[model samples]
Target: MSSTANTTYTTFTGWVDPPTDIRPPLTENFTCSVAVIGGGLAGMATALRLAERGVDTVLLESDFCGHGAGSRNAGQLASAPGGDIQLLNLLYRKGMPAIIRLTENAAGHVESMIEKLGIDCDYEAVGNVFAAVSRGQLGRTRRIAKILRRAGAHVEEGTARELGIPHGFLGGMREIKGGIMNPGKLLRGLRSAVLASTVRVFEQSKVVDIVRGNGGVTVETPGGVILAQKVVLATNAYAGEWDITPKRLSSPMWVTEVETEPISPQRLAALGWTSRSGLITQHNIMENYRLTARNTIVFGVRQIERAASYPLPERHPDPAVVADLAKAFARRFPPLADVAIDRTWGGWIGITSTWLPVAGTVGDDVYYSLACNGHGLAQATYVGTLIADRIATGITPDDLRTIWVDEPKFGHAVPMIMGRLGLRAAWTADRFNDMINGSKRHAREGFATAAGGFTAPA
Candidate 1:
């Protein structure tokens, strides 16, 4: 809460403003070879690929493309999969290697795409770190590093000094494959490419219903109906808007991101963040911090708010949550404690039951990809391209086959349980651990009144 009352709350992301050149909504009935629903990163990539292959494709979006998590994410292209690697390994032992390979390759795909598209998104090849704030988290990092390395991921474990991170952290493992970038610019670049290509794009086109009859699927928006041979539903968090989507396909979680007022170069350099790698704390609900090219630092997501119903409403970051995040910022980057929070924003992102990125077919002509989890930056784009290729040529690539599900059935309502009460419990546990760690640190430092005075990072 450290005097973050001046922070500007925004419904959209703080990365970039809403695009001025919004494409007109569909106004007439149309037929096409393929129709892509939801113009986020995945849909745009899918339609773009289809158009490049000479397929008559139409991309339908409620808002402008990249308006969702595509532009709102922290922009860390992770080499390893999202969620706990140890859990993933224990659950899907044999699938771990393929998943690891896919994630690393996904990051490479983004790097290559950035170069090929000539995007000036302030991309830095400095890989991201799975940082540890306490001794328990440091041990967790070591164990996770071992799991990742056994699965063939390129990672390094070391102390904060060796990793070039801030001294506030004990140590962490660095994923050497992926890096950080200006996701807003990257999305704009992709949007430009899609608009320039032959793919017909319609903005502000809210789809009302989707009906499959005879040989084609009829996608109905408010203004018109589109009859296409195939349909690709790439809507991330809004997938629940359609009844056709699988039960428990994913959960929509609202996470916030806040940026600090610009800091001087000397102040930033004093933190010894030489590697300039984005840092993600190893908590149950992770907190991510990254330095922007604008000389400001952006961090968020210590707590998550899950949506109650579908058609997720547009909203700003909760003030209480933003305050909590600011307190966390002060602890993690004490050098920037006095820095004012410039603005705060929140976006809806989908997390699968398994905490894995998934792509599959609902029927014969309907295809879907959802829940890139938190690794949507690289994973979504790559999976979208794979889906496009699969539809373009009648063959599925091995990489695509790795995550492709034969049956679209999913487990019970796990996300609902993880929503409010579960989140509160997890937060309480983290805080309790932090208190214990703080007491130990104070005892070592010979502080007599450590019990009530110490507040540690967890």
Candidate 2:
């Protein structure tokens, strides 16, 4: 590995501190109607739903619940369909309504969950924007808006200034249903709700093997064995680690994020970001930016790292990658260029070849839900609920049936070398655009250029 690749940095998620009340791991063989693996958002949601239905459910987590991507993500509860919307429109043509409904309902479901469960996660219904940093990207954003509108999604197009985005973004498409939140708090809230339910939850319980039997499934962890009549694999990225999981179900991609020290309210106001909406750039590997309740700005993920093997080892954010993120942050918001980054953190996320969130059954008893791509914050929780309902009632709802696949066949995984080359190529293209637009340099005192390189009101 290159020196840059070998360098490591400590994990420091800026959302919130880990919860103090940790559940004990299972020490004896146990039986349950449903066993959900991986205590992230999906698992917690699944176990909570099953328990609410009076089904015997147990949840197992390698670490504390929400320690994974649940708390590690940028916390944008995006309502717009992820991945390439145009491509998805062409591919899943007749299923567009379901796709639109899924995205919209995902956001609504999360909102209802918070209200019903009385969980406070600083959620804002301010909506999210697919912003553009260049003229090329602005055009692309318009195309995306058209695609989304055609699919019956509610979207509006506007310039950065009109949208109250302080950065030098040209323009963007705004999805009306979703906003931002403290993911750590949200995850902890879900954890608390799940804990209050009758479901038995075990932390620090990593599953080593899964064996299918005549009527039930056996999940073996380091501490004990769990005999479950039905199993829901909410493992996401880690699903590929098990031999029983479908081959090439999803690729594990690691994404990094960093947060800055709190900015003064006056200074924040001067930037014209009054709407407090989250922003996502139009790069191939999109970069996300959002303001936290603490007044700190968090952003990252212009690039992604792929795991080389399954059973991914415990890894930290790379210092070099963190530095790259810092540079990107500075380039985007030049007025806040001097703000100090508090810390950088990252975690694994699953991405599918089709770039669509998928939920399906592996066999008669093993149900798997993986590959939310990058929109798992709302989709994961919603899908988990649907999966639980399906298992409980034996009748798949229309929403659940829309994303289900009988055979879990996927396209071949991209060769490692080719994937790296493609990433480099994409990065090169972004840099080329930056150079062409002179965006590498900080904007003037109070002016920034808009699309077509015209000076715009800030």
Candidate of highest lDDT: 1
Error of model 1, residue 362, in angstroms: 1.2
Clashing residue pairs in candidate 1 are none
Q: Which stretches of candidate 2 lie over 4 Å from their true place?
A: 1-9, 413-418, 439-454
- Ten-residue segment with the worst summed lDDT in candidate 2? 1-10
Candidate 1 lowest-lDDT run of ten:
449-458
Q: Candidate 2, residues 41-124: lDDT per residue as tens digits?
A: 889999999999999999999889998888989999999878777778888878888898898898999989988998889999
Off by over 4 Å in 1: 413-417, 446-458
| Deviation from native of the Cα of residue 77 in model 2, angstroms | 0.3
Models, CA RMSD each:
2.8, 3.8
How much is the lDDT of residue 98 in candidate 1? 90
Candidate 2 pairs with clashing backbones: none
